[model samples]
Target: MFANPMILFIQVMNSLSLAMNLFIIAAGLTLIFGVLRIVNFAHGAFYMVGAYVALSILRVTGDSNLGFLLGVLGAGALMGAMAFVVERGLLSRLYDKEHMLQLLFTFALVLVIKDLVKMIWGSGQYSIGAPPFLRGAVNLGISPYPKYALFLCVMGPIIAVAIWFFMERTRWGRILRAAREDRVMLNALGTDVKLVYSGVFVTGAALAAMGGALAAPRSAVDPGMDSLVIIDAFIIVIIGGLGSLLGSFVGALILGFLTVMGSIYLKEWVIVASYVMMVVILLVRPWGLFGKADEERH
Candidate 1:
C-alpha cells in the first residue's frame, strides 16, 4: 500500500480533511467541558440538527454558492439560539447539582433532541451536493483530488488559527479562560458568571453546528449520524485532554491519520488501531499530551 506515491498522497490528503472536521467538532466539546465542567451528551444532536437545517435551507434556495454560504451560517445561528435557550432553561438549574444529575440531564437532552429531529425531518437519509466551484478535482502533483477535500484541508488550519487568536487575544476569550480557572473569583469580581456560561455554551454549540454544515456536502445526513460523530468527538477529547484546544488539534490529526491509514493497509484492524493508539497515549501521559494535572482542592 505504501509503494504507490500517488496513493500515499491521496491517503494523506484524506486524513487531513477528516482531521479538520473532527477538530472543528471536538473543539467545541472541549471548550464546553473546560468551562462548564458538564459532559454534554446532546452535542452530537446539535451537529445532526445543523446538518438537517442546512440541507433544508439549501434545498429551498437551490445549490448556489450563496445558498451554501447561507445554509452553513444559518445552521450555526439556529443551533446557537437553541443552545442559548437550553442553557438558560435547563443547564443553569444544574450548576449546583451533583455531577451524576448533570450527566443525566444532558443525556436526557440527547433523547429529546433526537426525537425532535425525527419529528421534523423524519427517519430518512439526506445529503447536499458540494457548491459548483468545489465540484471537480484539482491536479496536485501526484494526482487529481476532489476540490472540496482540498478546500477542507486549507479551511481547517485557518479555523485553528482563528480560534487560537480568539482565545489568546480577545478580551472575551480571556474572560472565558479566567472563568474556567475560578468561576467564583470571576463572579465575585462582578462578572456575570451565568451570562458567561450561557455565552460559552452557545458559542460551543455554534461551532459544532458549523462543523455539521460543512460536513453535509460530503456525507449523508441521517438520524444516527449524531451518535457516530459524538463518539469520535469524545474519543478526540479524551485523547487530546479534556479542555485543551491545542490537544484537540493534535489528537484529531493523530486519530485521523491512524484511522485513514489503517483502513487502507490494515482493514480489519482499523477500529482497534485507533483505540490502541488512545490507550497507549493515555498510559504514557495520564493527563493527555497537553493536559495539566488538576490541583487538589481542600
Candidate 2:
C-alpha cells in the first residue's frame, strides 16, 4: 500500500483533511468542558441539528454558492441563539448541582433533540454537495486533491489561530482563562461570571453547529450521525487533554493518521487500535498529552 508515492501522498492529504474536520467539532467541546465543567453530551445532537438546518436552507436556496454560505451562517446563528436560551433558562440552574445531574441533564438533552430532529426531518439520511466554487480537484503538483478537502485543511488552522487570538490577545479571553482558574474569584471581582459562562456555552455550541454545517458537504445528514462523531470528538479531546485547544488540535492529528493509516494496515482491527492507544496514553499521562499537571478547574 505504501509503495506508490502518489497514492501515499493522497492518503496523507486525506488524513490531514479528516483531522481538521474533527478538530473543528472537538474545539468547542474542549472549550465548554474547560470553562463550564459540563461534559455536554448534547453537543453531538447540536451538530446533527446544524446539518439538518443547512439541508433545509439548501433546499430553499437551491444549491447556489450564496445559499451554501447562508446555510452555514444560519446554522451557526440559529444553534447559538437556541443554546443561549437553553444555557440561561436550563443549564444555568444546574451549574452548582452534582456532576451526575449535569451529565444526566445533557444526556436528556440528547434524547430530546434527537426525537425533535426525527420529527422534523424524518429518520432518513441526506447528503450535501460542496458548493460550485469548491467542487472539482485542485492541482497540488504531486497530486490533485479535492477542493473541499483542501478547504477543510485551510479552515482548521484559520479557526485555531482565530480562537487563539481571541483567547490569548483579547480581554474576554483573559477573563475566560481567569474563570478556568477561579471563577469564584472572578465573580467576586464583579465580573458577572454567569454572563461569561453563558457566552462560553453559546460560543461553544455555535462552533459545534458551524462545524456540522462545514462538514455536511462531506458526510451524511442523519439522525444517528451524532452518536458516531461525538465518540470521535471525545477521543480527540481526551487524547489531547480535555479543555486544551492545542491538545485537541494535536490529538485530532494523531487520531486522523491513526484512523486513516490503521484502516489500511489493521483493517478490521482498527477500532480496537484507537482505544488501545488511548489506554496507553492514559497509563503514561492521565491528564492527556497536552493536559496540564494541575488541570483541575477551580
Candidate 3:
C-alpha cells in the first residue's frame, strides 16, 4: 500500500544500482565521443566481453571473490588492448576522413564482435554465483536487500570518485582534456595526438569492460546483450550531454529512477518510458543537460 515507505526505499536502491552500471558504460562512451569524436558502437561489445570473461574465469578458478576481481581486471586489460589496436591500427587511418565513415567502421565492428562472441561462447545466457562472503541479505525497512546490491552501490560511487579524481587532478588527464579541446594546438605543442587518441580509446574500453564484468554476477551474460545495452547507453550519453562525466552520472540517475518507478507501476511500458524521457529532454535541450557544443572541427 501507499503506507509502505520501505518498499519505495528498496526500489530506489535497486534503481541506483542499475544506474551505477549505466553510468560506467555511459562515462566511457561520453569520453570517447568527446575526445576522439567517434561513437564507438562497439563499446557495448566490450561490455559483453567483460561479462563473458568473468563467467569463464569464475568457473575455471572456482573462487567466487577472486573470480569477480579477476573478471573485472582481466576484462579491462583485454578490452583495452583490443581498443588500442582498433584505434591505432584502424581508426588512426580514418582520422582525416568523414565522421560518417568512421562510424560505419565501428558499426561493422559491432557485428564482428557479436558473431565472434557467439562463435566462442554460443548464444546462451550464463551467470556466476556471488562470492560466499556476500551471499546474505540485509533487511531494510521496506524490503530485504541483497548484500551483492549493497556492495555494488558502494563500489559504484568509489569508481565514480576515482574517475573524477583521475580526470580532474592528474597531468595525463590535463593532456587528454587539451587534446579534446584543441588537437591541432596539442600536436603543434609537440604532443602525439595519435597516442592521446589511443590512450582515451583504451581507457574508455577498460571502463566499459569493468562495468560489464562487475554486473555478471547480477545478470546473465547473453549474446543479445551488446546491442541491447548500446541503445540505453546511447540515450544516457545523449541526455547527459556528450563528454561530461558529471552529466553521465546525473543522466544515469534520472533514467534509473524513472525505470524503477515506471516498472513498478507500468511494467509493460518501462522501455518506452526511458526513450520518452530522452525525447522530452532532447526537445528541451538539444545540447544536453551538461554538454556544450564542441567548437573544434576534427
Highest TM-score among the candidates is held by which one? 2
Least accurate stretch of 10 residues (summed lDDT) in model 2?
289-298
Model 1 TM-score, all chains together? 0.97
lDDT tens string, model 3, 1-298?
2467787678888888888878877888988988888888888998998888877877777876776778779889988998898888888998889989988998998899889999999997887777877888987655889988888778767877887888889988899889888899999999988888999999999988888887777877899878878887898888998888888889988887888788878789887998888888889987789888545333
**Greater-lDDT candidate between 2 and 3:** 2
Residue runs of model 2 more than 4 Å from their true location after superposition: 295-298
Q: Write the per-residue lDDT of candidate 1 for residues 238-291, one digit (tens) a residue.
A: 889888899999999988898898788889989788788778888998777877
True-vs-predicted CA distance for residue 28, candidate 1, Å: 0.7
Q: What is the TM-score of each candidate against the true structure?
A: 0.97, 0.98, 0.94
**For every candidate, C-alpha RMSD to the true structure in Å:** 1.4, 1.2, 1.9
Clashing pairs in 2: none
- Tens-digit lDDT track for model 2 on 9-123? 9999999999999999999999999899899999998898889999999999998899999999999899999999999999999999999999999999999999999999999
Model 2 residue 11 CA deviation in Å: 0.6
For residue 90, give model 3's deviation from the true position in Å. Answer: 0.7
lDDT of 2: 0.93
Stretches of candidate 3 off by over 4 Å are: 140-143, 294-298
